[model samples]
Target: MIGQVKKMIKQCFFSQNNIKYVDYKDLDLIKKFLNPHARIMSRKKTAVGARSQRQLAEAIKRARFMGLLPYLSR
Candidate 1:
């Protein structure tokens, strides 16, 4: 017989600290929400609320425009 295990999603960054803003300058933090391919993680995957997800998307775009984050991997 075999048993199945379930993994729980972690709390969102903003939610955990009650952060109201997602800054583009925080590359280290933002990058965590992006996959190795450079695509944004979905709300379901990040376990973030709708509002925070939108904020995160906007921040990522800003960072990309400023050349802080790569749009895609080579």
Candidate 2:
């Protein structure tokens, strides 16, 4: 169920340019899809588990309310 939700969110937010924003609610949905024990072990990985988790939190803050497009633009 969570995987499906995550896939939907990814398809909705990451795949489309028109979707410039995501909310905390949306982030929560994504968090539900994450594995708690996952760990990041890289310096140049796109989405390295735990590190990506942290990045996701920050990204959610930037994407939510305001939007992700501007940040991606930079």
Candidate 3:
């Protein structure tokens, strides 16, 4: 274990809440992944896995299409 650096793992929101699906209608949850400028956060920033990040992006897009979320924020 010499010179082996330990990486800290951050827990994902879905896993913590025991959520199975990413829902577009859940504005609160979706907002958490979006930045103040209304853009989706990166995986590194959100600390979410690849699959969850994809799902989150899809949900955000769907929400915006349905007029639930804003495309841009002031």
Candidate 4:
């Protein structure tokens, strides 16, 4: 294993998809960042950048406020 070179892969979804804006109405995308408990996942867990993570959090909060997404899991 001494000669093995670890490959670092970027797993940022927004970067891969070229999404500049995070939309609260996009349940599919927003749901990906939420855990079963309806909490926002951490940046390390989601592999999202700092800025994108903030945007995601804001969108999720907005969604919850608008009753589009649940505040807590059932």
Question: lDDT of each model, Cα atoms only?
Answer: 0.89, 0.40, 0.90, 0.92
Ranking by lDDT: 4, 3, 1, 2
lDDT of 3: 0.90
Give candidate 4 regions above 4 Å deviation.
Answer: 5-8
When summed lDDT is taken over every stretch of 10 residues in candidate 4, the lowest stretch is 2-11
| Model 2 CA deviation exceeding 4 Å by range | 1-48, 67-74
Pairs of residues clashing in candidate 3:
none
Clash pairs, model 1 backbone = none
Worst 10 residues of 3 by lDDT: 12-21
Q: After TM-score superposition, what is the CA distance of residue 20 in candidate 3 from its true location, in Å?
A: 1.3
- Please provide, for model 4 over 10-54, each residue's C-alpha lDDT reduced to its tens digit, 9 standing for 90 to 100: 689898889999999999999999999999998888799888988
| Ranked by TM-score, top first | 4, 3, 1, 2
Of candidates 3 and 1, the better by lDDT: 3
Q: RMSD per prediction, one decimal? A: 2.8, 12.9, 2.7, 1.4
Per-residue CA lDDT of candidate 1, range 1-74, in tens?
A: 24576667688778898989999998988998999899999987888878889999999999999999999985
Task: Determine which window of 10 residues in candidate 2 has minimal summed lDDT.
Answer: 8-17
The number of residue pairs in model 4 that clash at the backbone is 0
The prediction achieving the highest TM-score against the true structure is 4
- In candidate 2, what are the lDDT values of residues 1-74, reduced to their tens digit? 77666442223222243434334456554444334433222323333344344555555555444642222221
